[model samples]
Target: MGLLLLLPIVFVSNALVPTQRMTPWLRDLTTWNPISAVTAAARELLGNPNPAASIDAWPMQHPVHATPIWSSDY
Candidate 1:
């Protein structure tokens, strides 16, 4: 579920932002926005504070590093 939110952000950041003309605020959103939908869904499904188990391999460079919140520990 968390991966779902990350998907769009990652797509926009890596694909759209480079070629498109977006405002600074919009660019900021693209960079920092959290995937609320995915987070909520994960919370519902996992019933835990941590949603790391819900992430998959595609969007994450290293699936093992993917967590509910961004972490440099990865």
Candidate 2:
């Protein structure tokens, strides 16, 4: 059951693959996912290579700011 919940979030996000190659609807879904924000945030902070996203999704574009907001109590 754990895999059921966790797998979709991981696979659906950009952590495993770049969002540019995904379908438009799927890309949108992946871009807005919190997992993607977290991964993007990690890349930004750790100086990892982040491939340029073709679409300008707010979460992906500003993950450093998005991560905290997604995790916040408010």
Local distance difference test, each candidate: 0.41, 0.84
List runs of model 2 lying over 4 Å from the truth: 1-3, 52-54
Go through the candidates in order and give the C-alpha RMSD of each one to the true structure: 12.1, 1.8
Question: Any runs in candidate 1 off by more than 4 Å, and if so which?
Answer: 31-71
TM-score of each: 0.30, 0.84
Clashing pairs in 2: none
lDDT of 2 by residue, 5-56 (tens): 9887898888888888788899889989998999998998899977634458
Query: Which residue pairs clash within candidate 1?
Result: none
* For model 2, the run of ten residues with the poorest summed lDDT: 49-58
